[model samples]
Target: TILSSDAYQRSWKPNETNQQDERNFSRMVVRRLPAEVVADAITQATASNTRVTAMTSSPTDRTIGPDILAKNNKKLTSLNYTLSVFGKPDRTENCDCERSNAPTLLQAVFTRNDPSLISMINGSDRRAKGWIAEVQEWYSGKTKPTNQANGNKRLKQLNDQRKKLLAKAPKKPRNTRDAKATQRYQLTIKKHREAVQVLNRNISKLKGGRSNGNLVKRQITALETDKLINETFLRTVSRMPSANELNMARADINSNQDKIGGVKDLLWTLLNTKEFLVNH
Candidate 1:
């Protein structure tokens, strides 16, 4: 009988590996909120009718409302739930503790049309959250139609696709691949535009230039030398060259030195010229 069993085991063993063979799905034990949240959750569950009482001693001990309370004394005194994780890890024994954590309580208080969950942003945020939680729990417990599962199934698929795409995208910089990609783009892109010849070559294109847009016509600079006629009129007079009109006399001399009486007389007459109007 032992030999037959050994023969049977030998017959079942395979020498080669097959890639297409399906492997058993890995069983995952997800981290879950601990009992404290469950208890706080109970408070959240029966918030309306639930009244918490405590014993306080001033002179004598007396039964008082829960020491910390919100609007209706429904508060908690230190609500973090310490816990240990459990899972069947690879190369380890099953249900080994994975981590230690303190579970925070998620809470909500609501009236009709109020936020289902009270969040840090809004008191109503929690209330709405609680309502959503209740709805999810109903479906999770199989108490309601499994519609939530279907919804969650689609959500999980989309989330997985997004995660996969993100994972596949390049993560490391300063790589040859990145350098090549940048070089390729730089080579393909046009750095300077080609000169365009659009108008007819023979006919000068008419520019519909608005006078305002025409930038003051490259401002034709006039030669700063005085008008010949103005210089001649000044040289005709004999007057003393006043310091203010000294520049004017020089301008006259430069323009008509050749036609003047004599260089000395011209200088004398220029010095006496009345064009030098003296200040009172």
Candidate 2:
């Protein structure tokens, strides 16, 4: 019920009016996100396919077999360095206060000068084609990313998985000694149910439908310059750019000799901005 409230579901926005209405929650303040989120953003910005695997147990838990430990280590290595820079919590504290979201000098330096970030931007480490490549293809009208069929197929798979997880959930402990195991089983099921909720939200967005407006079409020729700029802004900052901002970006691209390079620089600038770096 709490999740259905306006405060919980409200979309965030920057404080554009500069009005001080703190008592009424008139606007949201921009905030530095947690380390895990920042790391995920870097991966998303680079278009890397690597995901942070859910760990079932502590990495240092000696009860786990060597094989499981090695697998966990391999998955951890992918984001460990980036997360460390933003101060990933060690999880030693009992309270959520252990994770710090304070802005730090190190974070700024890393965003500006990290070689790994540049390499990721360049599509190094066998990662999937980066966002720069995708945007370039988009500008050329070579791709149309929407497909309702695919969304429907994925929704079906998620529903099946949810059913299977429910079937496996333990109704009760096998014995008094197994009570802890039953509790853990129910927790895992709950986690999977939450994932279903997320997938449903995404499916709803897809179902909202696409139309051929004046600026862009849903079919092949979605390559209008205005469309590309708006798409970039939406993907990077979760909103469309204002007229002044859009005109400035369009002018920059038009004046630049190297079109691709200009686009790359534009995306890099956005990635480093406070809007992309935090939640508001």
Candidate 3:
């Protein structure tokens, strides 16, 4: 397995004697990730929820459920369309060599200003909620009230339904005749009550209004500058910034009055950096 192989476990630092030996696996030099991998990484890291598969395949490609697949087609359904610019494979050839890994000017341009990437970071048009929004929600101990309210309302409706189901069930000793139905009713009602309790607890935490413990309350307080910088580094580069990098990040953010915007700029800058974009 590659996971247990010497090559895969090799140190990243290049040894002077083997520096020129590309085939010998002397060191783990930086390498560009495959286009599809890059797209998947961005989707995961940013919680962009990008759809990767085409909603509609040609009838020739669809061996089953052709009519259903045809009806479900959508314009913006696949990430492959966007990834082609980065040299995603067309699968015309059987070899993996067909997928391009070489750097391109177009990829650089796309990383900097592509609307698809920007929308992922910022959020979709209908919903202005993405990584930044997620961080804000965490630090503020709140999400859009509308969403929370809707969730609570829906949960209540479901709980009410559960209650009705329970009422329709046979009662007590007589209910024992149908053991499975009585057991299911009792279990479901128990589950509904527990779920309602959890939702109410979460809502309380979101309001920053009297958590059962002080720890949760402290977590919901307004985000600190240093914490935001740390979060950006951890999310984009998968590590904490060095002292110098942290200072530089602070200086850039402190320069602006809009701290959230500063954090946004910092995140964007990090995501564009080679360290975040390539594997070393």
Which regions of candidate 2 fall more than 4 Å away from where they truly are? 1-29, 48-77, 135-223
lDDT of 3 by residue, 248-271 (tens): 988887887666678878888887
Model 3 quality (TM-score): 0.57
Ordered list by lDDT, greatest first: 3, 2, 1
TM-score of each: 0.14, 0.49, 0.57
Against the reference, the lDDT scores of all candidates come to: 0.30, 0.62, 0.64
lDDT of 1: 0.30
The lDDT, on a scale of 0 to 1, for candidate 2 is 0.62
Candidate 1 residue-wise lDDT at 253:
44
Ranking by TM-score: 3, 2, 1
Candidate 1 stretches with Cα past 4 Å from truth are 1-141, 172-180, 183-280
TM-score top scorer: 3
Residues 216-242 of candidate 2 have per-residue lDDT tens digits of: 422322255567677667657878889
